[model samples]
Target: MTELPPKPSRDELTERAARVRLLAFDVDGVLTDGGLYYGDGGEVMKRFDVKDGHGLVMARLAGLRTAILTARSSSIVEVRGRELGLAAVLQGRKNKAAGFRELLSQLEVSPEECAYMGDDVNDLGPLGMAGLSACPADAAAEVRQSVHYVARCRGGHGAARELVELCLRASGRWEATVQHMRDPDALQAVKL
Candidate 1:
């Protein structure tokens, strides 16, 4: 296994993550391993990590919004976004920076309040604009170097989940989120 690069200091990550209200991601390499599985009908199938989907749910429960921005549009993406209850899903956007800006505007959030994760060069614009930037272990060299965090896990594995846990922990919501995950009813009772 290739050794992962060192990440930013915990204090620095926590500070940036604390200010994050929205978490955005790229779909290709960041979420689906960048592989296009085409069938006989020229339709593409993308595989998503169940853990990553749950991570989004955890973030939402912790009071953070989630979104997806991709250069390609696909019905599968829409299905996954709806299943995860993502706050925003913007697809077929070649200029990711512009798309990210539009999303921020539509969501009424500032760049400083967002955390973005991507795995390729197309993501650089928004990655630079986000308060906290992250990439998967197998991300492009430029992307890995430019990001604030690089996961040990590869894309379509657990990279997204790792970032989500980092943000939740840094923001002091990990414990509660874990408690709820372990026993939702128990946590609700405690809240009551």
Candidate 2:
């Protein structure tokens, strides 16, 4: 049998993580509570964490890009992504790696400049390619073992916030990013 290439070690991951300019995540388990509800008319629904929304907003404020990829389509996710001004929103993507590559190419960014957070098998491919891969605390054993960081929170319960904070702090942009958000005069200050 042919030998496969070895995966990047944790130290290499940490060094490369400082260069990340984009942070993307898988939907469902990564963004939502992983619970789907079908109403009487068969309309589907999923709950997104508001703190996760704030995290994405903070990442955007730091001049880092943010996006979402979902294997199954959801109008709720679409609306939330648009509301958050995420740079890319990919849906119905069976091959997450393909979606990730397409988004990176579309954004004109390198994989070494990106991070990914995921929670399941479907998310593994993209996670594997990111400079710093993270997973929710409750992610599958294989997924947690494969990632560089395992969030303290579970999915849809501030997990995104935990990862976003980790990435921002790792890059030394978290304090600036939060201050920018807290100051309503920040944008106006830029104009003066």
- Model number with the top TM-score: 1
Candidate 1 lDDT over 119-156, as tens digits, reads 99999999989999999999999898888888999998
lDDT of 2 by residue, 13-110 (tens): 55666788989988888788899999999999998888888888888878889999878988888888888889999899889999999989989988
* Candidate 2, residue 93: how far the Cα is off, in Å: 0.3
Q: Tell me the whole-model lDDT of each prediction, alpha carbons only.
A: 0.89, 0.84
What is residue 191's positional error in candidate 2, in angstroms? 22
lDDT of 1 at 134: 92
* Cα distance off (Å), candidate 1, residue 176: 0.4
Looking at candidate 1, the ten consecutive residues that score lowest on lDDT are 183-192
